[model samples]
Structure formats: C-alpha cells, structure tokens
Target: MNVNGGRPQLSGTFGAVSSTHWLPSAAAMAVLEKGGNAFDAAAAAGFVLQVVEPHFNGLGGEVPIVSYRASTDRVQVVCGQGPTPASATADSIRRLGLNQIPGSGLLPAVVPGAFGAWMRLLAEHGTLPLADVLDHAIGYAENGFPLLTGAADAIEVMAPLFETEWLESGRVYLPDGRPPAAGSRFRNPALAQTYKRLLREATAAGGGHQAQLAAAEDAFYRGFVAEAIDSFVSTTEVLDSTGRRNKGFLTGQDMADWRATVEESAQVRYGNCTVHKPGPWSQSPVFLQQLALLDGFDLRRMGLDSAEYIHTVAECAKLAFADREAWYGDPDHGDVPLGTLLSAAYTEERRRLVEAKAASVLRPGSPDGRAPHIPEQVPDVLPPSRDHWMNQIRNGLPTVVRAAEARTDTCTIVVADRFGNMVAAVPSGGWLKSSPVVPGTGLSLGTRAQTMTLEQGHLNSFGPGRRPRTTLSPSLVLRDGKPVLAFGTPGGDRQDQWTLGFFLAVTEFGLDLQSATETLAFHTDHFAASFTPHEAHPRKLVVERDCDPGVVEELRTRGHEVELVPEQSLGKVCAVGVDRERDLLLAAASPRGRQSYAAAR
Candidate 1:
C-alpha cells in the first residue's frame, strides 16, 4: 500500500546502516565500506549521534545495546545504564527535603556510562582504532553541521534557564548570547576539544588497538573527565524539577567504579523467531512479556491496524508494563523473577485478562505465587495538570510548540554487515535540556536516576550504587539460531511498544521494513511512566492522526480515552536485517521526523 509514499527499502550484499540521523548513517556506511564490521560501524555511528543529535543524546548519556556476533553465534547485551552514586540513598535524597527525585540538574545525575559502553564494544569486538571510530564525530563537533530545528527550539525554550541558572550551558548553546537559528551551521568547539584531548592522551599511552581503547576509557572515567565532573558537581547547586537547587551526589569514585558489562540476553520464543532483550534492569523484558501474551492470539486473523488488533496489543502492553512497574529492577541488586515472568503458564494466566472491552485498570499478576508491589507514592490515576517545569523535565526530551512545532526525543542505531553480524542500540539521556552543561565538558549529566523510586522494599527502590530501571531498550530477533534482524526506536517508555508494532507488522502481517515503520502507531499510557513523578493516564490510548477514524471511535467506545496526535508523530524506528536465504542485507528508517535515514552498499 506504499504507506510511506516511495521511501525505498535498502537492500545490499555488502552492508546496511540505519540511524536517527543522516550523518551517523553515512558514517556507519563509510566504516563498512572501509572494511569495518558491524560492531565497528555501530560504534562509529553511535559517537556521531552524540554530536549531531545533542538534543537527544550526549557523551554523558546511557545506551543499552543488543548485538549478534557471527563468530560466536551468540546474542549479547551491553549494560551501559550506569548506577547511582555510592552516596545516593533514599534516606539521603529525602534528607534533602524532596520526596521524589527531580528530573533535571545534578541531583539525578548518575555515573555517565555511554563512553564506557562504547569503548567496551570497540575493544572487545571492533577491529578499528579508537581514533578512526571517533574521527567523524570530532569533525562534526569542530566544523559544525546544520542545526536541527528541534535542537534549535530546545535551546530557545531553555534559553532563559541557561542565561540565568546554567551559565555554562549558555556559553555553549547560546553562542552569540542567543539561541542559534534552525538550519544554521552550529558548532560545539568545547565538545570537539574534549574528544581531541581524549584521543591525544590515548595515542600517547597506546600500545595497540585494545590498549588505546582502554586508555580512552581511563581518560574519560578516571582521568581528566572524571576530575572535571567531580569538581563541578561538588561545587555547584542547580535548580531542578523539585523547585530547589541541589548538589549532586556523584563523585569521581563513582565513575571509576563503574564499567559496562556484557551479559546474556533474556529471550522468548514466538513462532519461529526467538526475540531477545536486556535483563529486567531495563524495561526491555516488557517486549518479551507482551510477545508471550500475544502468542496466544492469532494476530494474522485479527488483521493489521484493525480495532481488534489495536485493542489486543494495547491491552497486552498495559499488562506487561504493569509488571515492569511491579517487578523489573537491577538483577545485580535484587532478585528479578524473569524466568517465571516469561513462562508459558504465566502467559496463559495473564492472557485471559484481555477481554472484549478494554481494561481500564493497571493489573500486574503474581509470578510464581509472589505478590506484586508498586511504589506507594505512585498515583494510580493521572492528575489533570502538573508543574510546568516538572513536565519539561519528565523525559529530558525537549518540545517547543509553534505553528509547526519542533520536538526532539532519543536516538536509535542499527547496523548489519555482510559477515552476518548485527547490532541494535538505543542511545538516550544527557540531553542539553535535561541538565546544566558541566564546566569544561561539552556534555551534561543524565537524569536517569529520576527513574528510581523512594519506596523501600520495592524491586526498583533507590539505593547507593544501584542501577535505575531505564526505559532505553533495543531489540534483536533470531530465526533458527541465527541473527536476522536488529531494530529499535527513540521513545522513552513507549520504545518497546512502538517497536513491537513494527515487529508484529513484519512477522505477522507480511509487511516490509519501510511499510511496517509507516504503519499507524498507537500506545497505551495505562501504566506509570518510568520518568520522574511516574504518572499514569489510566485507559488512555494515543494513536496517530492517520489512524482510521472508525478504529479510533471503536477504541473509545471500548473505554479507552483516545487521544490523536499529528501524522508521523509517534515513533522514529530504524532497522537493519540480513536476508540470510537471499544473502542480502536490508535496512529502513522512519521518515516521520525527516531526520532518520538508511544507507546500504
């Protein structure tokens, strides 16, 4: 049906790359053309995204990666989501006169993990030198690139705060004492210099590729970058969503103590494909849980985008996310009953909850006879309105309302090389609007700690050195024990839901990547959000305006508070896959935001 007009699904035998921005996609393809594999291409593209999509991600952000290496014939997850500081306890936070963690400023800062995670990927799997992988990003930061309208709008919206409270940010974003115009060439010399210095130090101490990568990691986590972060965070008190200024708890020790780890992926078999995700620490498992529930239904019989299909998917999402709020947390800190959660018996028990009409309540089931517990402070019902500043800080993504509004969210990258290796990564947090730019560093600390709750004994309760259950999730699919597809998107809590729709379209409805990406998208905000204030809009089902009016009305009649957004406003999904049977690489990117692109040789 050419739902997305004429955007071609790129296919090649050499390599394919798809990312949230054109520059990153180009950079990744360039790496592949230069003989780099999927892992190397992914690392190169990831760094460039930190430069071009500053409004969406930065050096201080977090990224959770799912990759399939052909050599090992294994699917693994890289845990880039950093843990809270050793001093950041629930008691310490409450002592600061705050019930919930603020969404912005230093109080919610964690040990920045993006750089470490990328370095780990490169050192363990990549063949290229650190300098080679980072060159494209450094060039963009130094020479400047055309500013995205969304980035410009974010700067404009935060200009008052920058000028008054965050002077360091003003010095960078407000280059001429004002926000740069959209489409104008914008540069971040400070960021460029930061990258250059890291490279120089790495080169000076380098022995080989691995040694240089290790040196770069040390430079960021234990050397000058750590020193800068420590000094700034300890000395500065900044305004946040709590309506007060607070100093951060993070220290140089926190950064030094943290390292990205490669762990086994959580998997669930659906039809012929075995879907994999990160552990319960992230919201990744919700994807598998949803699939488990849907495995009972014949979605092909229900048809695509039909009222029946939308209802079933939305209901399953609500149930799965309820489990996320009740049970998902860092496995390193506590027990997460992932095995029981994905069990077929549990699936059948939960699948029965999906009825003829929409369920307006948030229902989390008992896994293995264990009762579910959510934070007591989290409201079951949505409030009419919230504080403006609190709303602004929720997801760290920025939005500016105008005649043609500009909104920037997270970033996604997926890569596939001819060697059968594939990578899917979602890089988010540390947005320019989320917190003040640290002095001397061109990046800001992430507000991911805001996802932690103060409710003690709860699975996701706040604790020192504990990892926050983040919303950044990436997906990888394998058929017959071979990696075939890698895909992800850039919505915070809605990430899994959006990508689930794309996956179902392809696997169940026989749609191609581009067509599946353009399919009408919908998600239920029926569970508490992972962001600060953790609000839930009960029974709310938001669909793109392009959705059939009949379907929208049907959902409303079934007890959903249907809200319609503009066309192409839901998810910016990017994907890459290998047609193993045909020996071809395939790639596609969402055309919604006019930013994401797909490239192939």
Candidate 2:
C-alpha cells in the first residue's frame, strides 16, 4: 500500500536490465547471463517488447538509441526515426481533403525503422549473432505467451474497427474472431515465421557475424518483409482516424533507400554532469533547457516533493516545450539554431518567465534574430490524454477514461554489462491501434508521419525523405567522461518532462534509482504536442493523485489548471545506473503501470 513501493534498486556486479515490459527484462537478463554485452541485451529486450506490447511498439516502429562503449569511451546515437515516403507531400494530403496527417492510417505510414536500427546495433556493437538475440522474441511469438489485460482490452475496444475497416488486423490480432482474454496464451505465428525466414536468409548467406547481420538487414528492407508491406499498402485502402479510406505511400524503394544513421549525441553540461540526448529531431533538448533554467534556482533547498519545487519545474517545462514547438525538428531539413537556443545566455534570458505563478502563454524565445516558427492553427483533433488504454494489460483492471484525447504510445529498454557497455533506447511507433497489420506479415506500419507539420519552410514541414520530428527521445548521462546512467520512458510529450524529474531526483535530491522512479511526477500540457493537430493546453498541469494535496492546491493558486491523475498512472520510466566506484550496477523500473521490470546479476 506504499505509494513509493517499487522494486528495490536492482544491484549487481555483473550486469542489469530494466525495461517497460517484464518479458523483455527477463530476456535481456538471460542474454547478459549468456555473456552478451549491453547492446546485445538491449537488442534482445527491444524485440521482446515488440512482441509482448503490441499496443505500444513493434518491429515496424522506430527506435532511437544512445549507447556508450567502454572500448571507445564515447557515446553515440542511432537515429532510427524514418523519413517520409518519396511521394509524401502536403499537396498530396490536401488532394485528399485533409489538413493534417491522420492519427491512425496507411496515409501516415513511414518506412519501418526499428528493425534496421536493432540490426545495426547488433552488427556494430553486440557480440551475439542475429539469430541468437532474436530467438527469444520468436519463441514467445510462436509458442505463445500470456497477453496483458490492456493489450487484450485494446483488441476488444478496436474489434469493431478491425472487423470491418482493418480486416488484416482482425486476422492478426483476433485469430479466433474474438479478442484474446487477459492472462490467456496468445500467439503470433505469422511474426514468428517472419523472424525465422529472416534468420534463415541471413544464415544461408554464409558469412561472419557482421556479414550475417548485414544479410538480416537486407532481408528485412530489400526482401520478403518489405514486399509484403508494400503489396498490402499499395492495394488496400483502410479506414483511419481521419474518417476516410486511404492507401499508404510507402514503397519497397522507400524501405530500401532508408536506413538508420549514426550521429553525435547532443549534450549540455550541468554541475559536472553532461547529459546526452538525440538531436533536434527529438524533444530531448528540452530537458537540457529545463536544467539550464533551473540552474539559477536552489532545487535541493526547496525539497524534492515540495510545492515550490514541482511548480518551478513544471513552469520551466512549459518554457522549454514551447521552444520545442517553435524550433525543434530534423536538423537535416534546414538550419536549426540549437547553439543559440541552448546557450547559457538564452536560458538566462528565458528564465525570467518563471515567476511565482504559472504562465499561460506560449513563449518561445527568438534566437539570433530569427523569429520562431510557431504554427498558426493547432486543431485539437486528439488532444493529449493520460487515459490508461492498456491499464488492463498492466493492472488487470477495467478501462478508465482519464482524458478525452490520445496519441502514439512507446516502450523503452536500458542495459548495462560488467564490461562498462551501456545502452538506452526508446522503441516506438506502429501501435496496433495506430494502423492496420500488414496482411500476412503480422507487422503494422508506423504513423510517425503525423509528427510532420504542413507549414512550408518549417523544419518539421512534410517533405519526401525527411524525418519527422519525433517524440521518441532517450537519454544517457556521463560523469567525468564515464557512462553513468542510461534511462528513458514511453510517454509521448511527457517523456522529457518526466526524465528531467528523475534526473533531478538523483542529482539534486540524492534519491536512489528506484526511489527516484517512484517519486511523484507531474506533467504540463502547456506546449504543442508532437502528434497530429499538435494541440496545446496552456497552463494545464496534471499531477499524480498521490502528490500532496497541499502541492496541488499551491499549483492551482498559482494559476495552473490542475488535473489529478490516479496514483501510479503517469510516466512509465525504466532506468539503470552504473556505480563503477562500488563495482555495482543499479537499476529501477516504474511501478505506475506494473509491467516495467528491473533485473540484475
């Protein structure tokens, strides 16, 4: 009955695995136990998450990874976010009488990017073969595993749509023409076959580990999987969130032309600690911005769960997120003033907005005399929500509507091995409810195209072969040039906000990993969302119900539109930290959803 009741900090001298799903956590630990390093464990864990948490992620999703190699003594990023199809354009959507990309459908489909990223990680950094790492996921998919109640309920909720609009999905998810009951064994033999064929193709190529990994990547993008995806989307027009039937623009060529890229980690130093995140394409920089703004305040003096601490952090989040809307996007698209935006002077100038009360306006600083590119109209098509769509899957409880809107959901994985290798990855997109299952493949195309904007000249504007500005941001932290932490969560817009809270809990309040994760978290919907319509609810703050009532009252008095969420229902953060000085690996997973797990030793 303790609100702070999460698994104790999982400590070990060998290795650790923490993930959004327990099945994957166990899989990763098993891999580590088999002498695989962090990359191998993470890759294995990520694939397992795709199979078990279909409502959240899949192989068809995107996975952005930040990893540290003990040999290289460096942090690197794998940009798994896929670009729009060659034919994707605003005019094309306009021709279909749509102003924004549909939240769910084929029209918003992008090149499946996760499989490529995972393969690349395994090929470049992992010691295990593609077949060894993937066998764990294939086993569960083929032999069957217990379905989470939330995933089962999701299938049930969408049964009507799947039955009539997305028959392919109905066949894949509801093999018996009915939703799989929670706790009942559910199998996806199609996906298992798909993995088996990929492994066989790679093995048949007769090559070394790297070459075989290359063959697996080739097989997925240039072989059968791509053909199946292309054939289904090219011929089938399915109903989507836009209330219309539409076919996808993705082609085999798009998948072939697209591959995950390696990039330098975006970083900012705060009090001897350098936090690293993916580039402008993700909402990660906001965490750094928040830290900069908070540098002028005495967070520890205010206390961890104090009203002043929560209010100040929430206000800084608003300012940082507002800038995310105005500026953050694919850096390759055009010039992004990241240097000026993350500058200390910029934070000092923007820091003045955080007064005693919440500021309701969207204020993005004009950096280097360039006016911010704020969207003119933000339709609240599917506004942000804290609804527990997969509550049953996580809690084995009935559905509860906490909000009136929705967006894409994701999952995360973090691994640390005895050799000092570490990895943090957020694998997302291709939610079962987001799009139809590709016929005969048990794979669903991602709707990441919804993250694009229609505004021409904007960094996130819809364009062919341009990566959409994604919300899938993972973070890695280093102290004294050594990898110390690898962590992330699955909340779309709330990802950075919650991550910042966890970081502060460690650095400022000195809470352990488990305690930090279980600490009461609050989120603000004051800035634009990354999903379709990109709705913004100015001054809105949703605090966990377990948060002190006095803090809630204080926030309300400070001009915040306070909404209380049920206890253990906000962010699902899973994190792992390495304490080399003590020869120990520490890990923690949020109990909010009950599915997150941490395994060590």
Candidate 3:
C-alpha cells in the first residue's frame, strides 16, 4: 500500500491548529479567528480535548508545552508536570507491599497539573479572557460532542470495574449505568458545572485577564476543588492495576505548594535548524540526541521509510532512550549533563554503535562516564497493543470490561497564529479508567507517579515534591533564530521516535506537513517504557505495515526483531509550520484512527 496520498497539507496566511481530534482543532481555529494568539488558541483547544477525549486526557491531567513567541523570538517550556505528594516515598509503596507503583489507582496520582498549567499560559501569554478561552469546552460538556470510538470502547472495557470498584468513575463514564455508544452525543453535566464554578470564582477574584486566570488557578489548587480532592483521596480506597486497594497520597497541601514554572529548553543545532524541547523532566531532549547522532548520515539520500533509513533512526532512538533510563530526571533533584550529552563529540561516539545490521541488544552510551542505571526489578513484559482492546468492540458499541492497564497513550496539539506565535503541547493523564472520578467533579487524578522508581539513588525515584520524568514531550523548531515548526505525537515511549521521523521528513526530504505525516514510520521497544511495569524489549523494531515488504524483509535480514503493525496505527502525530519566506502558514494531521485533523484560515 502506498502511504502518501490523503488530504493535501493545509495552507493559509492567517492561522492554524493541528490536533489529535477534530473538534478541538476547530475550537482552536475559532479562538485564532477571534484575535487570540497561539497560546490562547492552544489553551482553548486543550480544554476542549479534556472534555471530548477524556479517556486520553482531562482537566485533572498534566500538560508540558514548548512554544515560540514570535514577538520575542524566544523559545520556552511550560512545565505542567507536577510532583508526587509529599508523603509519597519509596517507603510509602513498600508499606503497601508493592515493589513498583501500580499503573493505575490513587497511589499513582500526583497533583493535577493540566488546569494550573493552562491557567499559567493564559495569565502570562494569552490575550483572551478565562471564560472566553474555556467557553467551547464548557459548552461541549454541558450540551454534548460525539463520543469517540476509542473512548467508548475504553469505557465499555472498564464499565464493570468502575461500577463495582470505582463507583465515582462509573458515575461519569457509565451515566445511566451503561457505556455511551460510539458517535453518540455524550454530555458530562458534572464537568460542565465544575468549569462553570471555576469561571465564576475567577470572576469574583479578578480585575483583568491575567488576574482572573490567577484566580482560576487558585480556585483549582487552594479552594473548593482542593477540599473536594483531599476529602475523596483521604477517605476512599480503590483497586489499582495491581489488584489491591490503596489510598492516594495527594493532599490539599501538595496542591497548594505546586505551581507550574517556565524552564530553559534543551536544544541542539543540526544542519540549518535548531530543535528545542523541554528539559530532562520530560522525554523531549532525547529527540535532540537522536538528531545529533544522525548528523553524519545522509538521511535524505537514504530515503524515507527505506530499510537503511528506518534501521539507522530506530537504532539511534534506542541509544538515546537508554541514556534516558540512566540519566534523565528532574534537574531540580540532580545534575543532568545535557551539554555533554548533546555535544557533537559525545553523539559521534554514540553513533558508532549503529551497525549495518540492527543490534539485538540495548546499548546506552556512557555520557560523562555515567553508566546507564536501570532499576533492578523493572518489568520486562510486553505490553498490550495500543489498538488491541479498541478492536474488541463490535459495531462501535460498548464491549465487556476485562482489563485495566495504565497506558501512556496521550493527545497533542500544534498551533501557529498570524502573529508568529507557535505552540506544541501534549496533554495527558487522568485517563477515564486510571483512577476514580472525584465526587461532584468530573475529574480523575493523574497516574504519572507510576513512572517513578522505588530504587534508591535512581534519578527518577519517588520522593516528596519531585516531578516524575514524564513521556509527554513536545517539540518546537527554530531556523536561524526564528520560530518555524511545532510538532508532536501521542504514543507512550514512541512519541520521540515518531516526531523525529516527521522532523527529518521536513528538513531532509523537504516534504510538506501532510506528506511528512503520511510517510511510513517505525518505532522500537529497545529501551524501558516510561510507564508502569517499565518493560523493555531489546532490539525489537515495530514498523508500520505500509512500509515496503522488501524493506521489511531486509530489516529482518539485518537482525531486528521486526513486528508489523496495521497501517497508520503507530503514531497520531500533528504538526504546524510557519513559512516566513512565503508568508504562508502550514498545518497537517495524521489520518490514523480518522480523528486527527488540521484546521486553518
């Protein structure tokens, strides 16, 4: 199957929004049309994603954004990934008789970061009022939007568990005691009221847009919302993926103490472009590392999706991610030698490991003589396919609840306004079945704490007020000190690998955004997962089925543990680019799952 022709890349002179879902894309474009900047449009679209794609993300989730403000010609990262509760420690999990934090449950929850992070963006960078920014989301929640097939299937699979063990979740997901039908107009009046109350509180506390957004943040972290969350977590116990009931560690104090901060991005100059990503707290820098390794290779000549191209890129990803397991963590807790890691000298040495044949092992280079440190009891099991359970539903109707596992599957948005502002943000966690919904609030706490380690001295080990090294990395690219591209995807460990391919497609092959997105891609499980159980499959390469069969055979001949996935099932990527030379704005979305879309004027 040829993997190239679908809709053409979207082009315009005004603005653009490329998101994992259609409705949010439209919502963002609407904001841009109303004179909102990229930040405001992104915030508005992000809130709508919480309402429509609750199984992937929610208001109770986290958002890590990398953006370029055209006015300042600067790149910045907004860190919305909050820390674990103060009481959460290695000892805390040991007390629960668990070796690793379960993938889902209150024990794995952290302070909800999405709301606060969005507010910070609005307060600092946006032009729209809080109510105006959130109006689309609130309207959708109160009235309705068509339920996604994937979300419906997820609810169907977890409905029984919610009813029996997480009754509050059942209240929201299975209103009227049944999973909402796919394509049905699903409404969550409770979540609508929750936002309405937040807006009202903001209005009560405000004199201006920035002040009102600050008040909204206060409402979420310090006022009635905090009290409700504390009450539920302190009093209730629920079964997690580990099959044991546990109480959460999050408290009102944790919420009040936590706030999103802006950080300098990790970046690298390759060829004519500079790529920027969030710090070690996220998996962003790994993409830069991959680019550094590929600097010596002629990727354009190797050709897109060819065996040589896929093999080289996938091998480099394995090496970079290996370093992630050994070194990347919240820099607030320890020193991360990012400068040395991204140096040409270091990457050249690491690139030597990529062989003509795929290496059937995990090889992480020593950055500054630091041996890669993996936890002793990390899970090495294979995870369920991202599409496995979703396929079980019949006729787009609800299916039976059989299993509940924490997935790193998230959502992404990319926006570019006429004013030169570009934003790439990944909002994830608080998946519908991850934790019980807070009573009276259509929200669930994030299971990001599940990514932390119990092993002492590990960079990502659990501790009070320490952010987990999250997999939610977003990317922004600048050319000759000017903002140009914003891109990201939604897949657990594969987020970096997929976006790396997309970037190379643009910079190397000179494809437009849509063609770059449609180009076949490949991923690897060679490094440990960033989610619970943290499994690793040394040298395994999963390629999309649309790739040439000859290339697939050649990849196998080279010793990769090759696995073929259904076409367009690997990454739900979206991207937007500003063509300064042409004075045109460009956007594109992957056709995978038929949900991703690009909207532009």
Global lDDT for candidate 1? 0.87
User: Under the 3 Å rule for N, CA and C atoms, how many clashes does model 2 have?
Assistant: 4
lDDT tens digits, residue span 197-240, model 3:
99999999859887888888898999989999999999988776
Candidate 2, residues 459-493, lDDT tens digits: the string is 87888988888888899999999988989998888
Residue 35: error of model 2 in Å? Answer: 1.3
Per-residue lDDT of candidate 1, residues 451-500 (tens digit): 88998888788899888999989999999999888999988889999999
User: Model 2's lDDT to the true fold?
Assistant: 0.84
Which pairs in model 3 have colliding backbones? 157-401
Off by over 4 Å in 3: 1-4, 378-408
- Models ranked on lDDT: 1, 3, 2
Best by TM-score: 1
User: Which residue segments of model 1 deviate by more than 4 Å?
Assistant: 1-4, 378-391, 394-408
Worst 10 residues of 3 by lDDT: 391-400
Question: What's the residue-level lDDT of 582 in candidate 3?
Answer: 84
Each prediction's RMSD over C-alphas, in Å, is 2.4, 3.6, 3.7
Top lDDT hit: 1
Clashing pairs in 1: none
Positional deviation of 22 in candidate 2, in angstroms? 0.9
